[model samples]
Target: MTTAGGRPPRRLRADARDNRDQLLAAARAEFTEQGTHASLNKIAQRAGVGAGTLYRHFPTLAALLAALIGDDVDALCATGRDLMTHPDPDEALAVWLHAVAVHATAMRGLVATQMAALRDRRTAGALAACHDAIRAAGVALLDRAHHHGSAPAHVDIADLLTLVNAAAWASEQAPDDAALLARLLALITAGLRA
Candidate 1:
């Protein structure tokens, strides 16, 4: 298979592919438990691989983060797809927005990592692709709500995402307080309604 630029996909040897998968799995677990600043050496150790092997697979932390966040964005988009079949457009939008907020704040410092990735030139392109996918899903939900007269016609996808990010930031600040996160999301949902 070829990529969008028409370059053939680089196929890894079976062992190399296993190593890469292990590194990604270890990195995900470490990042989730210890945040973005988690030690790379520890991740390598958890994966039962040498530090050099980890570096060989992912030369930079940003590269590793991009892969992790990209997977998350895919899952979030899938959630949006599943929500589309709901009877109420407003409810679907609300549920999807809440899911995005949860995903954005899933790990300690994840929002910060995402913001940094979005700004870093080396990682920006990959992150932007993921963000664009997410935005497309958000647009679908927003348009549905607008068509049903549940959301304001003037509201756009960006507006809803901004609110979602804010809620995610707030949730990060009070990670132990699920009620607080729920309340904040509820307020945002109410505000988005027509």
Candidate 2:
């Protein structure tokens, strides 16, 4: 089938599709246990596929992460879209940012990889697309907030995302603190208000 870009999408054979699915499942488990730096070979072995097969399916760590987290990113963007109709723009933004942070924390070391993908134009195609979706979502939320005058005119979407990512990273470092993310978000939003 042709994609929106007019390029025909590659269709895998049934066996290849099975192998890819297994690799993705194994990669998800390994990434959850060992963060983004999980061993590719280990994932391949766990999937009962060779390293070559894994490489064929996912050429890079960023590609693997992008495949694994693509659905979550879509959901986050959907949530952002839903919040556009919220009664309070500031609260909608705050809530959406919190959701973004929570999504980052859920994937353990995802924030760093996502931030890197945002900076690197040469990242895997899927990763780049995910970052684009995230950026668009953030921009939409920020636009809503700014239009309502709840956010300062100078508030930058990139800066807000970076702050949320940093908070998620900090929360990961302090895994024992159940409320660090919330506390950090509170401080961040307070600073925005100031």
Candidate 3:
């Protein structure tokens, strides 16, 4: 964002960037809990910034959402390496898959918002890159599991990803989340073994 002054773009100073980051972080938690309908004012207050600042950075809710989803997808993709260090491939996949599930469920109502962002070709590109990053993580997890000689070679990483994503979406309907997820994982893992 530049002014007509031919100077550098209106770069947010380190402190302002920090403020923006903080606001976005708060917005993430708030959105996850309450969704896009969460209180933007509370997000600002939680970030220790004025409402005006939040409005300045994100004029509409759509802007804030794209930022949050982008942040989450990026962070989750980076977690694959951390999972690889785990001693148990099964356990590693379990945790990472649950995270992916949570990530999908977190966007319960965000698809519409994301669509608007996607209309901006740049944002769509960013979103695709984000998905690809997560897909790479899934591939790595599959490879690590194979290396451990745990899951059978025939098991498809894409299938696991679909299961996790579906479970995440279905979780909203379950009363016993832990038991449900455990049962789902067990069924999937059994199929892998077979």
RMSD of every candidate to native, in Å, equals 2.5, 1.9, 5.5
Off by over 4 Å in 3: 1-10, 13-30, 33-63, 107-123, 175-178
Please report the candidate that would top lDDT against the real structure: 2
lDDT of 2 by residue, 1-194 (tens): 79899999978999999998999899888877888668999999999999999998888887888888888899999999999999988888899999888887765675455655568687567788887898899899889888883689898998898899889889899989989989999999878777
Per-model TM-score on C-alpha atoms: 0.84, 0.92, 0.62
Task: For candidate 1, give the lDDT of residue 53.
Answer: 98
Quote the positional error of residue 36 for candidate 2 in Å. 3.3
Task: Indicate the TM-score of model 3.
Answer: 0.62
CA lDDT scores, all candidates in order: 0.82, 0.85, 0.72
What tens-digit string does per-residue lDDT give for candidate 3 at 1-194? 45578676877899989988999889877876775478999999999999999998887765776677786777787787798898888778777877776677674535333543443556655455656677789889888888784778877776787677666556556856657766776676666655
Give the alpha carbon lDDT tens digit for every residue of 16-131 in model 1. Answer: 99998999899888988988678999999999999999988888776677677777788889999998888999999989988888877766766445754564555656666777
Give the poorly placed runs of model 1, Cα more than 4 Å off: 4-7, 115-122
- Using lDDT as the yardstick, the better of models 2 and 3 is 2
Clashes of 1: 0
Global CA lDDT of candidate 2, please? 0.85
lDDT of 2 at 163: 90
